[model samples]
Target: MSGPGTAAGAAGRAGQSDALEHLARVGLIAYGMVHVLVAWLALQLAWGGGSSESADQSGALATLAESPVGKPLLWVLAVGLVALALWQAAEVVRWRSGWSASGDTRKKAVEKTVKAVAKAVVYAALAVLAFRAATGGGQSGSGQQQQTTAGVLGWPGGRWLVAAAGLVVIGVGAHHVLKGLKKGFLEEIDLASAPPTAERTVTRLGQVGYPAKGVAFAVVGALLVYAALTFDPARASGLDGAMRTILDAPFGRVLLTLVALGIAAFGAFCFVRARYPERT
Candidate 1:
């Protein structure tokens, strides 16, 4: 009879399947498309024109849903995202299984584990959202975020909890900014296979894209902190709210335009990543 070790070995092999890797790469394309749409929406908001679409991932997915082949595309995106999530899950398992044998320091192992876990959660959530959009049961992420904030605020010490959450988000944003500025993202890409021009293009896109995304997230975190302090959930709107807030500032148009372009660059970078991912 096959024992646990035999079953585990089989499972590990399955997780490393080439088919799954291909699907995950396709999922990266879907993710890039979402960012491109968000950039378009943000530009519209910056110009004081365009429909009432929210300038965030939900809005991007909604825009996709309204296209001629929206539902079909969403289904594909959903499947790809699921595959990506599973890939991350496999990475987490590998990290755990090889933690001691890998010869890496404890800190490095922990960091890799954390990053894999985070990616798994994010990809899984996006997959669910895509599936919901495909099924005509989609809801606004910003609205949901606000509602969750409101509910939390109603609990004892909820304000503190919200503030803590906001701080964590800010920290994440700062990390992204640092990663971009430091070219840390290149560590994950096998640029050795890319042509010189392609390498330059991808590097530039990541450098610009990371900071823009970081700025947006930082603004969102600030809004959450403001909402907690004021005891008002309306102030806790997500990316959409952040864009509007930027619009109200001096030289808002210029700033928003730059940020939108940066987001677009990031989206383009995703396409390159899909094609040139580092092999484990």
Candidate 2:
């Protein structure tokens, strides 16, 4: 009786794992689609012709919501995102266990754990947003950020907290730039089985795309810092705001167009990545 029960439990767990993996795979494709949509909107903005979309993640979600089968798609996306979050959480747990081992080289372990935690947070957030969209809970990305900033500012030392958050975001952006330049993202895909030309194309796309995204993130962080210093929550722009800022710079249109193209490249890379994700 004990043996039978144990076997049944094992089978149940295996089934669950398989389901999650499938969900994650589907979620990756959805994620890629969002990025691609964002890239398209950004390009339109660069050309000085586009919808009144926010040109951010929220905008991407909104675009999907506008489709004929948008609600169902959003629901699917929400589930996939949840699966991705779970997968990342599992990674964090697994890494934490290794980090606890008696080893002098804990630095790498710590870094990986941090990365996993960050990814999990992001996946979870996206999942929430998708569910909200599916349920008709519409909210602009910039509006949401401002609301959070306002709430934070109400707290003691809120400015400092905002500043700290800005710095962290800036650091993340810098890391993206570095990762793209180094083609470090290649390690996250099954490029080993890809043809040489195909691999090179994907590498090029990532290299361009990552840096563009990093630039946008850095701009967003800078705006956040400015908002904190000025004690104005209204100034704390999100991704949409950051892109708009780029358009306000000298020769803004040209610069923005280049960035938009880079973003599009990244979107393309994401699509390829979804098809060949690294199996860990």
Pairs clashing in candidate 2? none
Model 2 misplacement above 4 A: 1-16, 102-104
* Candidate lDDT values, in order: 0.86, 0.82
- Over 217-275, each residue of candidate 2 has an lDDT whose tens digit, in order, gives 89899989998999999889798888889988999888888888887788788777767
TM-score, model 2 to reference: 0.90
Question: Which ten contiguous residues of candidate 2 have the minimum total lDDT?
Answer: 7-16
Candidate 1: regions farther than 4 A off: 1-12, 98-104
Q: How many backbone clashes does candidate 2 have?
A: 0
**Model 1, residue 211: displacement in angstroms?**
0.5
